[model samples]
Target: MNKPQIRAHGLLDLLRLVAAWLFYSSTIFFHGSYLSPLLVHGYPEAGSLAIYGYMGVNLFFLISGFVIAWSAEGRNWTEFAAARFARLYPGFLVCMTASFVVQTLAANPTLPYDPSTWAANLFIVAPAFNRPFVDGVYWSIVLEIVFYGWVAIALFFGVFSRWKLQLGAAWLLMSVLNESVVHSTALQMVFITQYAPYFAGGIIAQHIVAKGSSTEALLLLAAAFLLSCKEVTAGADWMQAHFGFSPPLSSLLAANVIVYALFGGALLLRRRIAPTPLVLVLGGLTYPLYLLHQKIGTLWLNALSPAVGRWVALAIVLTALLSASFVISFFIEKPIRKPLISLLLPRLNMMASKLRLDRPA
Candidate 1:
């Protein structure tokens, strides 16, 4: 029964930075191919921390749901669609291009761009074209797009204006079925079934935090956490099947518990932090950091290891990659988003106006 109260939230923004740092350190420090040369020399295996780091994507989905719901207040379906597009696509295009260029040049890159795969990935859903993502990290982007699509549909139908909790609860129930019962690839693809709990968690968080607290939101929040806990076991099975190795189930469970705690605890303390521009910018850096950190950071490590020694190389590379992401967030993404919104919002408003269902009752 609660409506979204959109506002700038500093604590949530800072938590996003934490998730980004977790994933970034896991990627760069663990020394996969981008880092193997340095890692092979002496870096310790991140072990359980690396496994836990995988759940950072879950945190991202949760935060995104919260952000979208908050941002959706007072906006028409068309305007919502435009804002989401401008927020994501321009930076994605630039980062993908940069990733492609870097991967092509790296000696042992994982995301070598085949023209077809690269082209398909430009849209963030290469699977739709029957191709793999240009980089492994892209699967999250696909899930995000799918989430946006469903929300946009709700907007089109004009129900999202008043039905946020009902829709979130419904999605959470379906996600529970998808995780516990029949495992359907179709369900997973369209509904983002495996990851729905996290998204639902964000939605629940939004309802609780933005609209003031309520019992319904609390119960759904508990359900979402339980479902996410279930995913830890499933994720272990997945890793074993594909990668020929699996971390201990206890380790996986512990990691999930820790992340859910961190995320949930942070949300609980949202008002304790001040909403500052620097914190907000740190939040903005997460997207570019996520995009740039993986293969590129590793590539830098590989190139630098013998010349600088692994540890020193890691320090330099981490500093540089983090700075690059900061620069992209501050200069590229921010500057472009403002102009893009001005140009696109009017057109989207027109499109949504034509949809009879989109009109407010």
Candidate 2:
């Protein structure tokens, strides 16, 4: 077997940091009044503006598509599965437990903090068990896991490399059909129809990086971009139904354009970005920050805002969350990841061998 083909780039790390900040400062603080009324009582206009920040989630999916493609290279399905589990589960376990503890202490009505809920959350499919996530932001994590599962299946079938474009095209078509005409909850859950375009765009981005651009790739990318733009508004519609207000359609469209531009720029400039330690740290902290920010920060704001002021409370909460994320990433997650992978991989490989899934079909 050859070494991995894809190289790490700091630009992607920088983008992850940007996405985390956008979600924290804009979506959680301003537009998320529906989740926590206290956070947005006096910031209606800001909420409108900040609602555009939800595009950060779309950015995440695009990055995931690219990174996961990069990761899947030069590895079998077992290795891929083990690597993903080691990468995600440690941070998820630590952060989810922390959030549950904070929620329990705060006793926030909006956030649940029971032992059963916490136990269900350990699987990242708490909703399937009829429990809420410790943090609402975890909904995206579930989608990511589903995407990973599909990628692993593709790898096992030996189709991911041979039929990449064909699969992507089919996915894009199904996405359009499901979102526009089918509107089936089961399809949305299974295929992730609404967000398929962004993921396809990311995968196409990685293909360009690896093989250089071609007519088919560029055309597929363009289709993905257009579909992404169209689907992004669905989020706004959801906000309107729930929160009674959402960012203007023009603002949403503008933000979508900017996101794609930024992603494209990052890919173009990746060689120059130099994967520095600071950049790696920023990227590493993003996951923990995303997991820990919303519910814990809201609970902190509920306490601190009463004693201090809202702005001060916001500053304090952001600083604390950043600090906690750093600690979790460097101290807890890093140390545990290698050992966890080492322990899991042999077992995973053994199971794969028994099932004859260690080799691609």
Candidate 3:
């Protein structure tokens, strides 16, 4: 099979910016009101519009499915594991620590700042330690890690590439049953039942690109898209129950359609979008921006809004966070990732060899 022609383009970065700024920063952060009680909250019309921004998380999962599949191709489980660790851990450490310090200094009652919580968050599964995430957005990172673990396991068993379609179909079926019928929290959490469609769609997308589309692939993609539209509404239901507001069902479905369209457009236009330095920089900063944005930005808003007025305060917070993101991406992650990978990969490979799983790169 031909290697997937996945290329680095700025489109996904642009989507990340939308997810960070438009969805989380502009809409849900303010709309949820759980995190930022101090901000102005009388604008129902605006809140209605902003509620759809939550679908950015869906967009992220879709992107991850494609990117992770591409990254896993032809690599053994250890290499894939090492690469994913190198990619995720350094940035997470820097950003999580930054969040810890900021939340500590701000002393915000809404954000956790306890040392135990901070220590637990260091592992990125704070809930297992009975501590909350320093930032609520870290929940999605955990899901991404779970997906990566499944991929690594699949690679280990030598079934990932060969059985992707069958696996995706089975996963989709399980997602449907778990979400709509069984309603099992354990399944939802362990299998990511609610969001499986997006990931499966992304993997199918990668498969289509690499192996060329088949009738079966197209049908599965369509099924995944339709299921995604159905599943994203689960977020709206939660928001409605908690916040007493959500985008109209029509709006939610339409937004999912639009997000899927954007993904398709990005794929179709990947060749047209050059991997320019500015583009790379924009994409590079996305992870840090996502990591550092929510809790820290809200604290900034709560602190600065009373003084500078809300709009001005938001601008200031965004500007500072963007600058911080750039610094972390360029100065911290770029510098640390390679050396960390170099130091870590061989150890992992040695362990793999000991386990008799090592293969030539």
lDDT of each: 0.75, 0.82, 0.80
| Residue 35 miss distance in model 2 (angstroms) | 4.1
| TM-scores for every predicted model | 0.89, 0.94, 0.92
- Residue lDDT tens for model 3, 16-132: 554455455544344434423635432244544555656788888888898888778888888888889988988999999989898888786766677898899889999999999
Please, what are the lDDT tens digits per residue for candidate 2 over residues 1-361?
3333424445667767766766667766454444556453334446446557677888889988988887787677888898899999989999999999988887877766679999999999999999999888899999999999999999998888777777888999999999999999999989999999988888888888887888998999999999998897898798899778877888888889988987888788777776678878978889999898877877787788778877788789889998999999999988988898899989998998898778762
Candidate 3: where are CA atoms >4 Å away?
1-6, 9-25, 28-45, 357-361
Candidate 1's residue-wise lDDT over 80-168, tens digit each? 77889988998788887787777776644444457886788877887788876655677788788888888888877778757878988
Model 1 residue runs over 4 Å out of place are 1-9, 29-42, 45-48, 107-115, 243-245, 354-358
Best by lDDT: 2
Q: What is the lDDT of residue 3 in candidate 2?
A: 30
Question: Which pairs clash (backbone N, Cα, C closer than 3 Å) in model 2?
Answer: none
- Higher TM-score: candidate 1 or 3? 3
Question: Which model, 2 or 3, shows the larger TM-score?
Answer: 2
